[model samples]
Target: MLVVTTACNLDCAYCYEGGGNGQGEMMDLDTALRALDLVAASNQPFHVQLTGGEPLLAGELVFRILEYIRNNNLPATTAIQTNGVLLDHQTARRLHSFGTAVGVSVDGLPAIQEQLRGQGAATWKALAMLDSERVPFSVTTVLSSRNTRDLSTLGMALHSMPAASAIGLDLLVQKGSAAAKIGVQPPDAVTIRSGVTRLLATLDVLNAQRSRPLILRERQTVLKALGRDEARPYCQACTGSSLAVTPRGELYPCTQTLGDARFHLGTLDHPRLSGTALPDGRLPKREECAGCGLQGRCPGDCPSRLHYNGADGAGLVCALYRTICDYCLYKGEIPS
Candidate 1:
């Protein structure tokens, strides 16, 4: 993943890298090129997701990378993940020409959104611009303690947004300063199970009603995982699949590992891509899970959440994942 810049215009409470204090921190252009060259040299197909506090914050860098990819005919799929607040009409047009699929962040209506993103309606306007430009985009709603219970309401709201081609629900992993101060974290296991069920049912209604229905990533993900060849539950080990590039050209296993120097993979100029040495602390380590039949289907919980705040909160959500997995495995009740 190319982290163009760590600066974001919005003061979202759950920002993983704190906030715009990282405004000036940007990945050097040469570092970006080197990263791409290394990937292309492998002669393999891959995806380079441009992400940051907001990639659009560094529009020039984003454009340069896209142009380079096209000119070189790199065998890679490129996309950007942005907050959508700065995605103006012209910017949207430029991205469209580059064949970039945008994934924007949108929690809910103004009241709910402002709670985490501060007092602003810029995101709403950006969403409108995306629709006006007919930009192909999707929404990522970060579920927090504040909005978990009302996911069904959020589902209905997203359904009404023509710009949203899908909704990807992300449970907050309290890591950075901004995220830790979000006031409420994710709810307990039982509550999450109930809330997600409601959200899934609401999506079912939308799928039945709309001709080009927005996709439910949660539902789709669960379905795909269940059908996979792995007999055990799978946790997307961040180090194995991808790495996040820092502004200084430093590499880390994932964005969640930012600020923690322990996981540094080395620099782009002197690259050392370590995929196998990541510690178990970065994964679910509950000893009791060893003999459980469900271990293959639902590991413990997200490691990012477990050690985020210098606390072990993974058990809270681990129980939740277990409950949901049980229903899916035994009851045959998929997320949708």
Candidate 2:
């Protein structure tokens, strides 16, 4: 994940990047190029994720990176995670032309979005623009007390967007603005289980009726676990397979662990990226998770989340996965 810039245009209530108030630095062209070189040296199929406070905020830099990837024919698949408020027609066209997959952060339905991220109308318009341009994209919602009850409704809304191929539910990490006294929090285990149940049911029915199914990212993980597939790394950061570069070219295991010294590999000029050890140099094992039915099938929660929420964090995710796996067993027909 290349954090093109720490600056962002939005002040989301749950922004883990310290509200991305545009006070952060931007990545210069040299830093971005060096990061790409590191990626190329891996000699494996790589996924370059361009992210930031809002990557489009540094539009010129983003385009330059994209152009570099294209001109050099780098062996990499690219994507950009944006809030979608700045996804105008021209920006959308440029992104599509570059074959860059897009992931938009939207809390939920308009009202819920407005309450959390603000600029509900702008984000909605961006989704419409993506659909109009036929740009395939996915929606990522930060599940919290604020939007847990409306997961099904959010699914239904995304169901109408032809270009929306999936919805990824990310638990609220209690850091940055979310760590504030009045900040958003992850829903309780019960709320997550219930919300996930409704969401799975909604997606099951929706998939049964559509030629192109809207995938629930977490549900897919549950399905893979149920099938007893070999457990893959929870994320690039989990196994230290990917390096996240900050605006100033500092490197970490992944985007979520950007600032912590423990996860810091080194700077772009003197990278310390090596080995397969996790960012913390240890696999997170929880006593509570011992002997759970999901066990190895579930790769576990994000380390950064576990760090923020401690042992308590696992329960919420555990409830979610267990509900999905149990639901599939009960239905006897896992929805595609």
User: Best by lDDT, which number?
Assistant: 2
Model 2 bad stretches (over 4 Å) = 229-232, 279-293, 334-336
Any idea how many clashes model 1 has?
Answer: 3
State residue 135's C-alpha deviation in candidate 2, in Å.
Answer: 0.8
What's the count of clashing pairs in each model shown? 3, 0
Report the lDDT tens digits of candidate 1 across residue range 1-336: 888888777777767776565456777789899889877888988788898877887889999999999999998888998877777888999999988998888787767778877534777778777877888788888777777778778778767666668877766777665455647566666677787777767877786877678787655555554564443323344336567788888887677787677777788777678551343333355764575434555433344455564433666555445544554556575433
TM-score of predicted structure 1: 0.85
Off by over 4 Å in 1: 178-182, 229-239, 275-295, 299-312, 319-336
Candidate 1 local distance difference test against the native = 0.71
Candidate 2 on 1-336: residue-level lDDT in tens?
889889888889977767856677899999899889878987878888999988998999999999999999899889999999989989999999999999999889888888899889899989989999989999999988989988999989988887899999888777778778375777988898888899999999888877799998987777776677455666666666777899888988777777878778889888887742463322345564575556666757777777776656667777777777778778884534
Per-candidate Cα RMSD to the true structure, in Å, reads: 3.5, 2.5
lDDT, model 2, position 327: 83
